[model samples]
Each structure stands twice: as structure tokens, then as C-alpha cells.
Target: MKNGPLFFFGLFAALTLSWAGTVLLSHHQLGGLAPFYDENESAAFPLRQPGVAARGQLVYADLGCASCHTQQVRRPEFGADQAHGWGERQSVARDYIFQARPQLGALRVGPDLANLGGRKPAYDSDDLISLLYTGVIPGAKAVTHPYYKFLFDERPVVGEKSAVALKLTGALAASAGSQIVPTERAQSLVAFLLSLNNSYDYPEARPFVEKTEKKEGEKK
Candidate 1:
């Protein structure tokens, strides 16, 4: 009561300083970031997303996919992201300058997808669709991905099976004379998921490699 005005002013100042430290400082550091151009490759890193993939990124957000999966890869020393084959290098602020609303999620309910597009033995689009439809592929180990069946449609076969109809077996197969097909939104979402590659080795992303001294007279 006696010092109410001063107490309120101190609280307000503290909140303003905190906001400036986090938001304003970050913006000043990263707001003007530009793509890293490689002379040998003659191109820039982190290409812009295709139209469909951009739409799909929105779909990914709308479906709350970030709640389970993260798009960021932790440093090797910080975690086992490299060992898990999620990414070869740690993600950096440059990796996300092109992303309108970067989904740098905080949990790892599923695999990190920052480099999914560049994964070796890359995921087949059909396989990804099936995984999205059923949350698991045939004979694969248990999958934690939630089923996104709402993205597909089960409809009676018209003249012939639609070209886009999914190939299904087991109980997931549609009833006789019926087919399961991915909607345009489903396709877009998959496009976004596949576009989540952050494989470009930005200088900032590269890990610090400490040079070790060889033991005396060990070898030349």
C-alpha cells in the first residue's frame, strides 16, 4: 500500500527488460540473416519450400505434429541425435531463416525430422503415405506415430480404383469394392514432412573438432 507505485514500476521494468533480452536481442542477431552461399556448389543453403510443401507445413502445424516430433537436431555432444540418424550435424539459426514460423519443438515423442528429406535409403512417398495412414508399415517394429486416418478417404470403387488409391492389405484394407485414398491435404502434409531436410552443412552447424595431440613418438 505505502510503496505500491514503486513496487509496480519495478515489476514493469523487470518484465520489459526480460522481453527485450529474449525477443529484441534475438531479433537483432538473426533478423537479417541471409542464406549461406557456397561458391563450389554455386547455390545457397536451405532452399525455399515448394508451394505444396509450404501448405503442408501449415497442415503439419494444424495437426499438432510438432507436439510429438521435433524439427531440431541436437548437437552430438549434447545428445544422440547424430547416433540416432536424425541428423549429421547440429541445427543452427541459419537453418530456419526461411521458415516463416519455425516449429523448433521441445519434445522427442518421435524421431527428429529436421533431416528426414536427406536421410539415406530415403523414405518412399508411398511408404510414408502408408505410415501416415496406419501409423506403421507392414512388419516394421512398433511405431509411436499416431494414426492420421482422417487424412484419407474410404470410398466405394467407381469405374476403377483411383490412381492415387493406397495399396493396402491386412485389416487396414478397405472393404470389398472400396478403396483408401489420401486427400490433397494429406499429400500436402506429406510434402511438408519430406521438405523438412536440414542437411546443408552450414558453418555454424558444424561441430567444433578438437585436435588431439598424439602421444610422444607414437607415429608420424
Candidate 2:
């Protein structure tokens, strides 16, 4: 207690050690992870994203979607991610090996999208495009999602109305002679969302079942 300099040195050492253990150690463990190769599928896990999906990933980052949604699913014992139909298995580093900038978001305001593309009753490209334009789930009463109307443009129909033009009603309907069509950016963003699939079962992603020994008790 009398040695003030020694006390300060000890405190600094403790802080430095903790940072190294938590931050540096974790990076070292997962930084060089590689994609898992599935023999039956004859392709490596975490398939590379196409050019449009890659660009869409950039858009996703710019729009700060990660602020509200997470891309990772927790282990079954840790949470009900699998039971709730979020994912079949816990997410592992191998799932993001091909991503330029993995969006392992910090929050979970929205559902985990790691397996969105592989969900039952899969959401097709058109479905995602419509959702982005309208912010309304097909049957839901309330429109809780933020509408990305700016992603689309209202242009007067030329020779033919756009095939991709959204069919709207009520206040959201386009003005007469105009149709709402998603821009290239919007299309790419949808592609990115639809590309979010991590359904492959990697060895590392499987749950760890701890073995226990039976104590020599009266009951057999």
C-alpha cells in the first residue's frame, strides 16, 4: 500500500493483460479461419458471393443495417435460435470466410439473417424486392419495417410499363402514368439479402455435448 508507483504499475499491467487476452487472443484464434469443405456437396462451404451480391453487401454496410440486425446465431443451449427457426446450427467463423467485410452485427433488434435465404418457404428475389419497396410483410397488419421508397424511382411509362414496377394501392400507389421501379442499387441490395444463407453444417458449428460420469449412488 505504501508503494504508490508499484500499485499504479500493477493496475496498468492488469488492464493490458486483460485486453491482450480478450481482444488479441480472439483475433489470433479466428483471423485465419478457412471455409469448410463438404465432401457430399462437392463444394466448399460459404460459397463466394456474386458481383452484385458483393456490391449489395457494401450497400448494407453503408445503410447501417447491422445496427438493428445480427448475422450470427447462437448455440441451442445458449439460446433458442434453432428452436425458433432462425438457423439449424450455430454460426461459425467458417460461414464468413469468403466475405470481404463480415457483418457480424452487435445487436439483435431484428431476427438473425444468417439463414434467411435457406428458410422454409424461401423468400424469392421478387419477395425481397417488394418488401424493401413497401416495408410491409405480406399478411402483417402493422408496417413495422422502415420503407426504402428512396431506393425506387417513379417514372412515366414509356413504350411499356416496367416489368419490375411494384403494384401498389392506396396512398402508396404511384401517380397516374407513372410506375415505381427499383433502382440498380435496390436490386443489388436485394440480391445481397437473398444471398445470406449459412445452412451448411460445419463440424465446428455443431453443438458440443459434454459427457458426464455417473456417481456411484444407490440408484442404478
Please, what is the whole-model Cα lDDT of each candidate in the order they appear? Answer: 0.85, 0.84
lDDT value, residue 46 of candidate 1: 82
TM-score of each: 0.88, 0.83
Model 2 C-alpha lDDT per residue in residues 114-164, reported as the tens digit of each score: 888888778887877777877877567577788898899999999899988
Model 1 stretches astray by more than 4 angstroms = 137-143, 209-220
Candidate 1 per-residue C-alpha lDDT over 128-156 given as tens digits, one digit per residue, 9 for 90 to 100: 89899988854596765678899999899
Alpha-carbon runs more than 4 Å astray in model 2: 1-16, 210-220
Q: Evaluate model 2: give its TM-score.
A: 0.83
Q: After superposition, how far is residue 84 of candidate 2 from its true place, in Å?
A: 2.4
